[model samples]
Target: AQSVAQPEDQVNVAEGNPLTVKCTYSVSGNPYLFWYVQYPNRGLQFLLKYITGDNLVKGSYGFEAEFNKSQTSFHLKKPSALVSDSALYFCAVSQRGTNAGKSTFGDGTTLTVKP
Candidate 1:
């Protein structure tokens, strides 16, 4: 089984400041980690993923995430935040080789970027 956790329910940041949203996961085997953003009344949008490559992976809208095997973490980061970046972020994980493509997701973290 695979699971994901976002310790923080909300993250507040100022525009032009760096921001990070924490996430942790557990899986039986190799894992596929993903980050998604959901705007108001819209479906989730893919941001980044960490399948099997470098520890650090970049993603859309100037966002990035680093996969830490030792810590079992995949925290999302942005160098400079923007007010428009405010949204609900989710962390998802799925065990590799799983028959179903279903992914376990975190409760979600609401990001509020103040201008």
Candidate 2:
């Protein structure tokens, strides 16, 4: 079965420090990976995605992720954290079969940045 696991429920970090939210996935064949952020009660905003090509993919909000095919991991990273960056982060995967458009999301990881 294809699934994503975000090990950390929440991560607390000081503003300006580098931050990372881990994600690992299991699936058959290649997967379309995505990262989204949701603010209080709002819909998720797309952050980044690893479809194909380079291992490091950059996206909005100064965030980037490395796609590790061997370990089957796609971990989100940022060089510097911000207080405003604190929100719920979700890792999603879309399959290549008939359910391509459908995305399965991880439980979510709440990032708390202290100023």
Candidates in order: C-alpha RMSD to true structure = 0.9, 1.0
TM-score of 1: 0.97
Candidate 2 residues 31-112, lDDT tens each?
Answer: 8999999999899999999999999999998999999999989999999999999999999987777375578899999999
In lDDT terms, which candidate is top? 1
Per-residue lDDT of model 1, residues 1-115, tens digit only = 5789999999999999999999999998778999999999999999999989799999999999999998999999999999999999999998888754688999999999999
Provide the overall lDDT of each model, using Cα atoms, as 2-decimal numbers. Answer: 0.95, 0.93
- Looking at candidate 1, the ten consecutive residues that score lowest on lDDT are 94-103
